[model samples]
Target: MSTTPRIEVAAVADALYGKWKEERLAGRALASDPRLQTIPGQSMDEHRERVLEQLGLLVEAGAIQRAFPKHLGGSDNHGGNIAGFQELVFADPSMQIKSGVQWGLFGAAILHLGTEHHHNTWLPDVMSLKLPGAFAMTEIGHGSDVASVGTTATYDPETEEFVIHTPFKGAWKEFLGNAALHGQAAVVFAQLITNGVNHGVHAFMVPIRTPDGQMMPGIGSEDDGVKGGLNGIDNGRLHFTNVRIPRTNLLNRYGDVAADGTYSSHIESPGRRFFTMIGTLVQGRVSLDGAAVNAMKGALAIALRYGSERRQFSGADGKEVVLLDYGHYQRRLLPRLAETYAMQFADHKLLETFDEVFSGANDTDENREDLETLAAALKPLSTWAALDTLQEAREATGGAGFIAKNRLTGWRADLDIYVTFEGDNNVLLQLVGKRLLTEYAEQFKDGDVAAIAKVVAGQIGEGAARFGLRQMGQSIADLGKVARSVEGVRDPETQQALLADRVQTMVAQIAM
Candidate 1:
């Protein structure tokens, strides 16, 4: 009798669906609805308008309110909120990102950075789609270095207001989602200058347009015309020429300015305060990570299904072979399929950490730092993997994948920006690297030689085991022949040990 391994489909699916399975399924149902799906070949203007309409549909379906406070009509289920939000990639990446811009960035800035007054005044409108806004943080001069953005919010004690200004061309806010047309307001980030003290970067609620669609005084808007992808979002630039907003417009949860122009913050260090405020908005990266994974899943689904059915050249038996039955075809997509599963579980873990921190259940400085580092580390890998997987899947399907209707080409184009936005992938990884170094240094800071020796010894053992030294010993012990390294490499524990050792080696090298 011969034995063959069998997969439990339902069990695997349940594991992949994760803790927020119901929310993900609900999002999938919404994504599957024809009204919300993307129409290939639509012009930029048409696509933008269609996506805007879809936002209203989402509001009606009550799909955009999960992250808000329950008293304000949301369920406050932060993890579930993201799980559902990520599924929008199946419908349209543009819609997913645009919604993220509105709620996840703009409104979330107010919710997390602002006080209760700002929330009571703004979040209701935000949740209902009645007030569309832009998150004006990225300037032409600054992308990842947000703390150094050229825009300024200078205090005016005489007028009791903060005058928001883009002093130079470089300071103009660029690539904002709603600035091209629909945004009536923006959460503008700028250096807060109060009482002649430069108090680092801060967010201010600045109205850019009136209800009648006219630009507010001292505010100029320019449309960012067609680009590589996500044109469904009205990406545009905004500049402020001493635009005055009320003193109360400062979203000052982390730092605040008094009416007398005195700046005060719970965190005394300007850098720490800025990071704490920014860390509150880590949801963007969290959602993008999951969205990228979802995109990979969709692409693989299309390619794998097509490969299993679409017949190609003749096989050994002289019948036209199914594409998936070919060795090279499986080689091309199976690894990506496995990687997507890994990314899915990784994203779920990240989401759980985000919920723990945001929900205040496990909100601690250490945990917040861990969450940020985890997001920074995983987001780049997943997004880059998504692009790679999508492209490979496209190529595997041959001409059929290139066709617009199949979604591979369109998704590849749209997701091209993922690796760069929500903090550029390279920059994010640099942050992760920095954190790893900091943690590594802390272990040695206490000058415990025994502890250091143990750590070094453990790393050496791991390195030796992974690099064949221990395996060589095992082969010699078994007989005078080398053991099959491939079999050991396939073991889960061995694979993990190898990866961990590699990271340790790199970190040790850098520290030295």
Candidate 2:
């Protein structure tokens, strides 16, 4: 492939890229730090403690402080922060995710969704790891469907508070990363009801632990315990029953309820308001996408390195075949190598778009929507790619890969959840397809038959060219043989045009 894109194992210029360097350096520090290593038996209690200790090391190093406000001791280079945050997957996926719980999910919810008052009250402690928290949004039965979560925050004008309740068992938030341990609080999501009208799911900073460190009243929690991997995080479930807090507890950027139980907001459209509130934290998806891409690169690097060095067969005396030289091995790896490259290129573009939307560089509704869709589209692809790459790399290593000492198997096992945990791959892709469909339908919203006709005619013309209706045979047909076509594809512009054209053609066909 002439037009090859390169994925970064160590990227430059991205805000997250610089943070990756810091993480690399920090990872080195934890290399000898005993607390960073996973325990053999891997019980929840034992693992959570080790991770907490490791968090202290990370915080002391000021690693997670990179993308926040400088006044709060953060570097505030939003994009670069995530770039580095993702590289932690190399050292340990557990560390990467646990740190994400603290910073990416928990901290981001506060940073993006909360007001300055909320920031002043909560950020410093949270940023310093003095107050670890959970992003309690994913209910057990409503993981992807946030709109219909069974929890509620009913406004009480009598006390100027919102009483949070998990009205149904299904509303008990589950699989929360920090809930079982380390977290002292959570940014809980619940249906916002004021004056008897539901305003949809909204977030609230609810304390789960007291100052002396006890689980708060009416807050029930249970550890999710161990299974496949990423055991370092204390995945858990939380349920709220009559959890009452001040009305200000609501992270009311998009909407707010008054002491009189009256509701009003800058965004009048409830759907847009909800999306706007949620879109503020799209960085979680962006960062995850980048990290997943990095994981793929790491697997490829280790696999490619070992492949080059640890040869199998011989074409000559005492010469084992360099794995890359074998067409079979290259066929197995090279296309994925190309795909990883595409994901990397696409993710960088998406992250840039995310920064543009979130960092106030060009924060428009359209840009925010674009960023969210891009994140949803690519995160699943990259994460699934990482898991596959890791598994393939592990398999390539044969017996050596099976042993935990090589790290690939361990990484592979840990990454297994990536496919399902973050918004689930199929559901996420469905969202992407819907977005594309929405965009397509808008083109015909005016009932413009001419426009529809124009598109159909263009698609038919393109299809004809592709299948040789326009030419006697084919435009480049028999220019030579396979070798001739290969040579033509070798030109970067040719490859890029062909690639871009294929996407357009496919979409047009699907739309029709």
Candidate 3:
């Protein structure tokens, strides 16, 4: 007789879900809050305002301040804060993304990139939602190419302020959350010019609107209108024409300017300094990784429960079998379930590493680079996985999933843009490829020429393996007899070797 596999599901769930106890509890409470529930049939404008109200509720619950400094009435619990924030996807994706824009990007720019003066002056209003803002980094012309932005912040020595301007239409800050209507200020990124010399890119806190909702002079914006998803956010574009702010407005953790218009950075290389400033914003990607995983979990929970209780056809015993009992249905969900469990463990590890780096426990250049690379790699996978899983879950549920109240379609729609945000998936993969090559080159720096040549040959072999040319060659040598393809594919050792070999080959090709 055959026996089923024995596993401790509760133990595994607790292990994966209990990493940040207090934060997870807060998330669960928020998920269950009746006031935060999504209202069916609400218009786009109503949804946007509803999400804003939900943000206020999050502030009242003290759930959004955990990641800020402890002196500013926050817990300074970076990892826990992300863990809690990601879980809000369960309540409503629009609300989750809107809150992320408010705190993770806008507020985080001030907290992570700016100094104590900024923290003391702005964080209180930010944490309390008294001052809504946007993180305006992406430009119409320079989406992923942040370093080449055309917006300029020219230092004026006579006035001791920086004049911010969009040199052309493409230079306008585009697709900024909270920018269309709600944002009163923004952390605008522009190329810094001082003493007639360019200093790469830096962030400046610019007030865009007054408390009464009127645009400030020299600042103009237009609403993005209805988007395909995440309509709860007031996405918009911003343009500046000689908008001047005090020189002290620069978030100068990495680069600074003097009263005499002398620009200096602690890191001598402008390229390195720019990267360091951008690295501080890695928390956005980290939080997205966790959120994608949880979204997969939420969708799976609904689908699997419905499948177990649902029956379609009658069996030999004159009773209908549960939908999950069908082999095709099992194939659709069981593998996904296994992958989701793996992602849960992987996401927890990523969150822990993020906390270690941000909390100053393991802060180092190598660790930060590792954290950034891991986030880049994992966010793409998890977000892609989420969209795929939600789509499959929707199909599996048949007409039930189509109903708006079931949330499958909503989940899929809200998550679609995740592939394009924080960092575009393709762009992020390119970063990973570059980093791998850099590390690989460093390892062989002192090696013999013969050894390096041998490594190059081995990489070629990997590429050859991917093409199945080796198998064809063996078949020719064997006089039309080839090895069993299924047997080779089923071998675990062979599968691992094939995957590793293929990845190495792709990276090598990209490097060339």
The lDDT of each candidate is 0.92, 0.79, 0.89
Clashes of each: 0, 9, 0
Q: At residue 335, what lDDT does model 2 achieve?
A: 82
Candidate 3 global lDDT: 0.89
120-167 per-residue lDDT for model 3 (tens digits): 999999999999999999999999999999999999999999999999
Error of 1 at 392 (Å): 1.0
How much is 494 displaced in model 2, in angstroms?
Answer: 3.7
The regions of model 1 sitting more than 4 angstroms off are 459-462, 465-494
- Local error of candidate 3 at 120, Å? 0.7
lDDT by residue for model 1 (1-512), tens: 75888899999999988999999999999999999999999999999999999999999988889999998999989999999999999999999999999999998999999999999999999999889999999999999899999999999999999999999999999999999999999999999999888999999999999877899999999999998999899999999998899999999899988899999899999999999999999999999999999999999999999999999889888999999988989999999999999999999999999999998989999999999999999999999999999999899889989999999999999999999989999999999999999989988888999989976776665455544446545645666544555466566766675677678788988897
Per residue, candidate 2 scores C-alpha lDDT tens digits across 314-362 of: 9677777788888888877778888887787787788678767656898
Best lDDT goes to which candidate?
1
> How do the candidates rank by lDDT, highest first?
1, 3, 2
CA lDDT, candidate 1, residue 127: 90
